[model samples]
Structure formats: C-alpha cells, structure tokens
Target: MAFVTIRDVAQKAGVSITAVSQILHGKGRFSNETKELVRRTVDELGYVPDSRAQGIRLAESKTVGLLVPDIRNPFFADLVSSMEKMLYEKGYSTLIGTSAEDVERQDAFITTLLGQRIDGAIVVPEGAESPGIRSIIDRDLPLVFVDRTVEGLDTVPSVVSDPYPGIESAVETLSQLGHRRVGFVSHSSLESVSVNEREVAFRAIAGRVLGEDGVAVVDCDNTFRSRKDALMELLSEGVSAILFAYSPDAIAIIGLLHDRNMDPGTDISVVSFDDIDAFRLMTPRVAIISQQTADMGRQGVEMLLSRIGAKRRRRAEHRRIPTVFVQRGSVGVAPPERRM
Candidate 1:
C-alpha cells in the first residue's frame, strides 16, 4: 500500500488540501463536524504524519521525552501516568522510554530521544553513573531528574524526597514499640542517591535513636533474593524489627518469613520505605514511609517546562519533596524472644 498523505485525507474527506492542512495543524475556520470528518478520514486512511517534518513545520514537536528505570514498577507506572496527564492538559505529549535499570539501555534511550529532537526530557535515573541522563544535562536539553539523581549532575534541576521525616518517624515509632536493635534492609553504598540517603539517614537517625550499635544494616541488591542471606543474618543476630528500604524488600521479607514458619508482625515487626497497595492489603498491614510519587511527577514536569530554554535565571533549581509515615498493623511491640 502507498503511504497515505494529507492529499489522500483531503480527497477522502471531500475537503481542499489547504483546509485539511489548516485543520490538521489546528488552524483555519472549520466547523467541528468538518474537523471531525477530516480526523476520521485521516485515521481510516492510516495517514501517519512525519514527526520530523511536523517538527520542522511547527518549530517545536510539542513532545517531551520521559525515561524510567522500569515501567513494571507500580510506583514508576503511577508517576508516568500523572506526568502524562499533566503534560497532556498543557497540550504536550510524552515519549516514554524504559531503562530496565541498565546503564547502557538508559544511554541508548537518551540517544534515541535526543535523535528524535525531543523538546525536553524528564528522567528517573537508575544510578549515579547514568551518562545517558547526564548527557541531556551536558547538552542543556531541558532535563529534570525525579526520585533519584546522578552524582556530579547536581547542577541540573531535580525533584527528590528528603526521606528524613518518614525515616525519623519510623525509628521513633519502632523505639516506642520496644525495639532496641532494628535492622535496615537497603542496597549497597554508592549505588544511587535514594539508597545512599536512606542508608545515611538510617545510620544517623536509627543509630542515634536506638543508641550506638543498636542498628543493624543489610546492604544488598534491590532484589529480595539477593538480600535474603542478609535477612537471615539480621534475623540470626536477633533484630526485633526490620525496616525494608523498598517495596520489593518488604514483599520479599514477608514471603521469606512465611516460608520459614516465622510470622510477619508477630514473630518480627516490619516497616517499609515505599508504600504500595499490596502492603495495605496484606494479612498484617505493613507500616510504610510514603513518598509523594504523583506529586513528584507533576513537580518534575513543571520544573522541566520552566527550564525549557534556561529562561529561569539561577544556578540550578532543586525541589526536595517531603515524605509521610503511615501506621499499620504490621508493626507491633517487639517480641520478647527477638529483643536483644
């Protein structure tokens, strides 16, 4: 089949090429019915417009590139949805790319979006060594980092959670529940800002609150399986309560406990940094330190747009979104048997 063009759409809709062009480009004095007919004919004929051609014609593609670690993660899904909604309302569209937590893949995504001449980009970087994400900043391509940020790219605009409020609340709440030695489940050091912040805060806050040597930290990969041995190690040391750094760690720990004939919340207490619906719906609802995922998305896009042309006269803009703590049944008085 031949490539359908605007001419074909105009002929099928019984309108002049000029009228079709006008309506297609959102111009001209055309009735709603006429516009609808042209749109339907364009769709029926599968007349796909060349975005590069369109970009040249409009001077701006009116499109933004968005990159995430993984779309399967519920938090990322929610973030992309909210960001897309907000951008759509502003008459802009998003071109989404996934890195799947691989640095090379992330670089490839950045290169592809850049090649497409994306007006700007928003990224939730996978780690500190995200050259792909950093390239956007180096080239001054209107970029905003959400959730976690790459190191040395602090000059770029960013929106990240402090993680102190909710973490402090968790330590305080656990201490009140008579937990002396609370374990922290997190990724290894130098992985990403998110993990590093959580680890630093946990050591400083939880250690200070629980007293010297009161905190036991398990620095492992993001996977539960990768951290399972660390979990058992912490368990063997008689940690009365454990704080999961993310949703995956929490879910994995819960499963591990059940498998070993240990009861979550009863045999040991649990707290998570990332809030998820599954945590709430679990048999023993898990307390969570919650980040404003949707708000982060909205704020990130707003910042990117504001800095699209470096219009804002400043060194760099940074927004630190605070987190909240949600209480649930999963955290209880530390079991006497487990208390050190």
Candidate 2:
C-alpha cells in the first residue's frame, strides 16, 4: 500500500499542501469549510500526520517517551497505564518501551526514543551506567526517573516509594501479633536503588521489632526452586513470619505453599510488596505494601512537564510516595512451636 502524504490530502481536498499542513496543526487562518474539507479528506484517505517530521520543524513532538523494566510486573503495568492516561489527558501521546530487565535492551530503547526526538523521557533506569541515558542528560533533554534511580543521576528529578512507612508498620504489626522471629526474602538477581532501599528499611525496622538475632534474611533468584529454598531456610531458623521485598517472589512462595497444602497463615505468615490483584485473589488473601502506583505516575509526569521547555532547568525536584501496608488474611498468630 502506498503511503498517503499531506500532498495526497491536499489534492483530494482541493487545497494547497501548505493549507493542509496549517489546517492539521491548527495554525494559520483558514476558512471553516477548508478545515472541514481537509479533515474529511484525511479521514477518507487515512492520512496520518508524520509527527517526527513535524517535530523537526516545530521543535515539539507533543509526545513523551516512557521506559519501564518488565511491564509484566503488575506494579509496572499499573504505573504505565496511569501515566499513559494522564499523558493523553494532557494532550500528549505516549511512546512506551520495555527493557525486560536487560541493560542492553534498556539502552536500545533509550536510543530509539532519542532517534524519534521525543520531547522528554520518564525512565525506570536499568542501571547506573548507560551511554544512552548519559546522552539524554548531556543533551539536556527533559527527563524524570520513576520507581528507581541510577547513581550520579541525582540532578534528575525522581519519584519513588518510601518503604519505611509500610515496612515499619508491617514489622510492628507482626511483633504485636507475637511474632518474635521474622524473615525477609529479597531478589538476589535484580539490583536497583529502590529494591536495595526496601531491604535496608526492612532490616532496620524488623531488627528493632524482632531484635538482631530474631531477624533472618534470604536472598534468592525468581525461580520457584530458589524461592522454596529461601522459604525453607527461614523456616529452619524458626521464623514464624516473613516479608518479601519483591512481590513476584512472594506470589511464587504462596503457590509453592498451596501445592504442599500448607496454610499460609497457620504454617507461615506472609506479607509482601505491591497490591496486585493476584494477591487479593489468593485463597487466603496476602497482605501487601503498596507503593501507590497512580500517584507515582502522576507525579513523575508532572516533574517531566515542569522541566520541558524551561529556560533554565531548575534544581531537580524529588518526590516520594509513602508506602502503605494493608492487612489481610495472610497474616496470623505466630505458631506456638516456631515462636522464639
């Protein structure tokens, strides 16, 4: 199929290409009839404006690039949906890319977004080192980091979850429930500023509640076998309750418990990050620490918009959405035999 250009729309609508261009962009004085004619012809011919070409001429794309790591993660999925909706409401289109937790893939997406001359970018960076991200910064492209941030990118505005509130509440709740020894399970394979922060927060909070000797931590990959091994490791240490820094690991452990016909509440109490639907739907609902996905998305976009087209970039602003802990059936009384 041949591509329909502005010239085609102009010819069909009985107008000059300049008229069609101005009419499409809502610029220049044109008769109402002419505007209607061009629009009708465009719809008839399925002529889509070349935003890239227009962006080059106008120095604005009215488009923003968003990059995330693994959209399959429910948290990221919700963030993406919220951001896209807000962007659309603001009369901008979203260009979304996913890295699937690969640094090289993340770089490739950044390169692609740059090639398209995106007006700005909101990134959940893959890591600290990336020529692509560095280039965007050096070029002074409007950028905001969300969910996670990279080292040396402090000058870039960011919105991330503050894990202290939720972690503290969770550990204190467990302590009140007579859980003397508790465990934390973290993803050993993935590294990020936010992930590390959650672990750090959990250690400090859990240590205070359960004491140094009473707190145990297991770091494992996302595999089921790894998660199972991590769970067994904590159980062997006589931990009556556990917290997961990563939600997928928590979900996996719950599945493993189901297969063995073990009660999550009775055999082992469970709490994890992210308020994904699956957690709520489990046979025994799982308690969660929610990072407030909608708020993160809205605030990240607001930061990016503030930086875009500013005469002088202001000192980068930072925002944190406090995590909230939700109590559910997954938490129960500490097993008498497992109590320290």
Candidate 3:
C-alpha cells in the first residue's frame, strides 16, 4: 500500500495543504473545529509525515524519546500509544525505550537517546534520584515526566494523576459496605510520586476508616514472585477487602486466588487502582480507580514540545489530572465474622 501523505490528509479533511502544515505546527489561524477535523482525518488515514523532509523544514531532528519504566503493564503501554499518536500528528518521530524498572537502564536509555540527537524526551521515572534525568535538565533538552516524577526533582515539568480523591472514594465505598479490614498491596519503591501519593492517601483515609491495625500494607520489590508473596501475606492477615495499588498486581492476585479455590468478589473483595480491559469480563467485574492516562500522555507531549520551543522554562509546570472511580462487582460487604 502507498504511504499516506499530508496532501491526502488535507484532501480528506477538505483543508488546504498549507492549513495542514500550519495546524501541525500549532500556528494555524484556522478555527479550532477545522484543526480538530484535520487531526481526526490524520488519525483515520494513518498519516505519518516523512521525518527527513520535516527535519529539513523545521531544522530539528524531528525525533523524540519516549522512555517507559515497563511496557508489560497495560497502563504504560496505553500511555505510550497515546503520546505516540499525538506526537505523530504533530510531525515528530518517537524513539521508544523501556527500562523494565531498572535504574541503570534508565540512565543508559537517556545516554543513548542523547547520542541519537533526539529533540526531546518523555519519561516515566524509575526511581527518585537519577543522574540521567539531571543531565537532561543540564543540557536543557526538552523533557517531561509521565505518570510519575523523580523525587526532589520539582524543577522538571511532569504530568501525573492526583490519586487522593480516588483513594478517598474507594475508602469510603469500602467502609460504607462494612469493610473494616482492608489491605494495600504495592511495589516497595516509593520514590515515584504516584506511588508515594497513593500510599500516603491510603494511610490517611483508609487508616482512619479502619483504624491502625485494621489496615495491612505489603510492599514488595521487583519480581512476580514477590508480588504474589505480598498478596498472600495480605490475605493471611485476614483482610476483608484487598486494594491492589496497580492493575497488574491485582490481576496476579486474582490468578492466585483462583488457584486456591477462592473467589474475588465473594471470598474476599478486590479493587485495583488502574483499569484493564479484562477487568470488565471477569465473573464479577473488578472495581477500578481509573487514572486520566490518555490526558497525562497528551499533556506530557504538549509540555515537551512547548519546552523545546522555549529552550528553557522560567518556571517548571506541573499538572495533576484527577482519577475517576469505576464501580464494578469486585467489592462486597464484609461477612459477619469473615472466613479465612
């Protein structure tokens, strides 16, 4: 099949080629509706601007780096897809890389992208302190953090979900349903802003609702075995409902429960912070605290491009999109005495 081009996009959108160019450059005098029409047309036609040609026109590399902590999780994969689509529409190529939550690889990926002379980067930070992140700032390369922010690196622009409201909602829902014992499961790393924020919120809200000992927390490091162990630990602690801090962890815990002839909605309630497609098809749909992941990805790319144009920002910009509570069948009222 022939490659789709800007002219084809313009023709389909009923706009001039110049309008398409100006819209892509974010300088079009066209109305917002016209621009959106062009965007939707570009998306439908799967048009990608030629990088070498656009590089010459813009005098830029026309390339950007997208560094993700891990792609195995649907959340990160969806995030990358959203950012990639937006950046592609804006006529930039993405150099995608994954660190698998390894700090060393995070630095290495940065060095590699820098050597490639990429114009900018959007990263999901692996941990709090990173020399590579600092170097990116020192070089003044356009950079933005998605989903998480490096600890103490408040000077860098970031797009993250404010999880407190969702956490509070979950706590209230569980409490009103007669859940007095709830467990929290998550990664041991707290350097990432989202994990730290969610954990703090859970402690403050769920802690108060359930009392001190009523709440159980199991923080594990890398490895599926560790995650499973954490979930098992929480179950052994006699939690009436389990709140998995991540979607992947919740899925894993469900598999473990099934293996032991346990049911999620009845044997013990389960809720996940992130939503997955499979959650809906389960025997009892899993409750979810849905983050504004698509918006986060879009804003990250927008901030990176804006920073790239400004060369340096006078003040670091930060945006925290709110999460939505999605009710499903994964939560139920606690039994009178509970059964282990």
Candidate 4:
C-alpha cells in the first residue's frame, strides 16, 4: 500500500493540507472541532507524519546528541539509558557518541553531531582543558556537561559530584579507624575536572589527617592489569587502606589482593568512588561515593529539552546535580601490622 501523506489525511478529514500540517506540527490557529477531525483521520489512516519533512519545514531537527567518555563504563551506560528513556517520553530522539577518553575522538564525535544538525547536546567531556570542548562551546550550541566540568566554560550547566567533601569524609572515616598510611588510586593525569577534584581533595585530606609520612598517591593506568599492579605495589609498601577513584579499579585491586592471599576487610580496607551493581554482590561489600546515575541522566535530558525549547525562544540556562557517599563493608579499621 502507498504510504499515507498529509494530503490524504486532509482530503479524508475535509481540511486543507496546510491545516493538516499545522495540526501535526502543533502550530497555527485551528478550531477544536477541526483539530479533532484531523487527529481522528490521522489515527484511522495510520498516517505517520514525515519527521524529516517537518524538520525541514520548521528548521529544527527535534533531536538531541549525547556524548560520553566511555560507553563500556557502567556509570555512563546507566546514564545513557536514563537519558534515552526521558527523551523518548518527551517526543525527542537521541544520537549517542563515545569519545573513548581520546580528545581527537571526542572532537570527531562533536563535529559529526553538529553536522547532523542536532538541536542540543549533553557532553561528558574528556578533560577540562580539552580544545575540542572549547570548540563546541564556541559554536554556542545548546550544550550541557555531565560527570565532568570544564574550567573555562562556566556558562554550560554541569551535573557532577562534589568530590572534596566526600573524599574528606572518607579520609576522616579511615583515620578514625586507626588508618595512618592511606593510599589513593586514580586515573593518570588530572585532566578531567571530576578526577582532578577527587585527587586534590584526597591528597589534601590525607595529608592533613595522616601527615607527610601517611599518604601515597598512585596513578592507575585505568586498566585491570595496571590497577592490579598499582595495588600490589601499594600493599608491598605497607599501605593499609586506599581510596579508589572508581568501582572497577577497586574490583581490580581486590582481585589482585585476593591473588596475594590478602583479606580485603581484615588485611586492607578499600573505598571506591562509584558504585556498580556488582559491587553490592562482592564478598565484602564495597563502600562507594555514589552519584544519582538515573537522576543525572533524567536531568540531562530535561536540560537538553529546555535548551531546545529556549533556543526556539532565543534563551539559555544552566543546571547542576548532587552526589552522595554510601558506606559499606569494604572500609574498616587499619591492620596494626600495616600501619605506618
């Protein structure tokens, strides 16, 4: 069967094609009776309005683009799922891109999204100083940042955890439990604002509480093997407790410690920043600094929608979300033998 078009609906409903277009686009003045007649005809005819045609007519795509550093990361995956769900309900579609922690890849994704004429975007930028992010900001597209904040660009709304207070609380908890030589495991380089904040906060807190001889900062290459090696090195150096930047790295360290016949709860204590589903099932539950992943995703979509609507009205706005710390079994008193 030939596809039903606006002309067919208009003819069947005894209305003009422009009337049908106006009704479908939710624009122009029309009587309620005429609008109801057009809508009923559309339903009966199974006529699906051509989105592309409508987009061309209005000069708007009615689509949003979402960019993340790594889709494989459970945190980003959950975030995407939440955003997509919210966008679907709001009559908008999403185009997703992954940067894989590379600036060039992020730049390419941004360029492609722009080329596709996406009305707005949500980006979890790779770094605060990334030139690609600056380029996107320069375009003045309706943009929001998730998970990380860029320093120079303050106008864009960002949803992120305040890492300092959380890190400080973790340090204080460990210290009160008699942990002296505490170590921190984080991804290499303080390029991303969230990472930088966590690192800076951890070091400052650890130094203030544990003193000069009590802190160790270890850079994890953000891989399983590298994280395992880093943990082994820390353990060898007599560090009894650690604050991990993320759950996956904490898992890697735990696995390595298990291989060395170290008991996570008794021999060493660990606290992770992000909670994954698997963390709850671990033998000793992992303590986590949890971000509201679903809320973040939902908020991102809401922000994008606001930007799209406001752009139509020539306006813009910014938004932010909060984070929380969840205590679990993984963090505990420091072993006397391992105390500095």
TM-score each candidate. Answer: 0.80, 0.83, 0.79, 0.76
lDDT score of residue 337 within candidate 2:
85
The CA-based lDDT of model 3 is what?
0.81
Provide the overall lDDT of each model, using Cα atoms, as 2-decimal numbers.
0.80, 0.86, 0.81, 0.77
Off by over 4 Å in 2: 1-57
Model 3 C-alpha lDDT per residue in residues 1-340, reported as the tens digit of each score: 2245678888899989889988988994888899899999977875555544432223377889999988877888889999999999999999999998888999988877765667889999887677778777776667888898877888888899988888888888888888888999866563566876777778888878778877888886656788878877887888888887777677878888889887877778888887667788788899999887888888899998888777436578999999887778888877676632
Per-residue lDDT for 274-319 in model 4, tens only? 7677778887888887777888777777776776676343334444
Q: lDDT rank, highest first?
A: 2, 3, 1, 4
lDDT of 1: 0.80
The window of 10 residues in a row where model 1 has the poorest summed lDDT is: 50-59
**Which is the better candidate, 2 or 4, if ranked by lDDT?**
2
> Of the candidates numbered 2 and 3, which has the greater lDDT value?
2
**Top candidate by lDDT:** 2
How many backbone overlaps does candidate 4 show? Answer: 0
Q: Is candidate 1 or candidate 2 better by lDDT?
A: 2
C-alpha RMSD of each candidate structure in angstroms: 11.1, 10.7, 14.2, 11.9
Candidate 4: pairs in clash? none
Query: Looking at candidate 1, what is the lDDT of residue 75?
Result: 75
Model 3: per-residue Cα lDDT at residue 302: 90
- Candidate 3 regions exceeding 4 Å error are 1-58
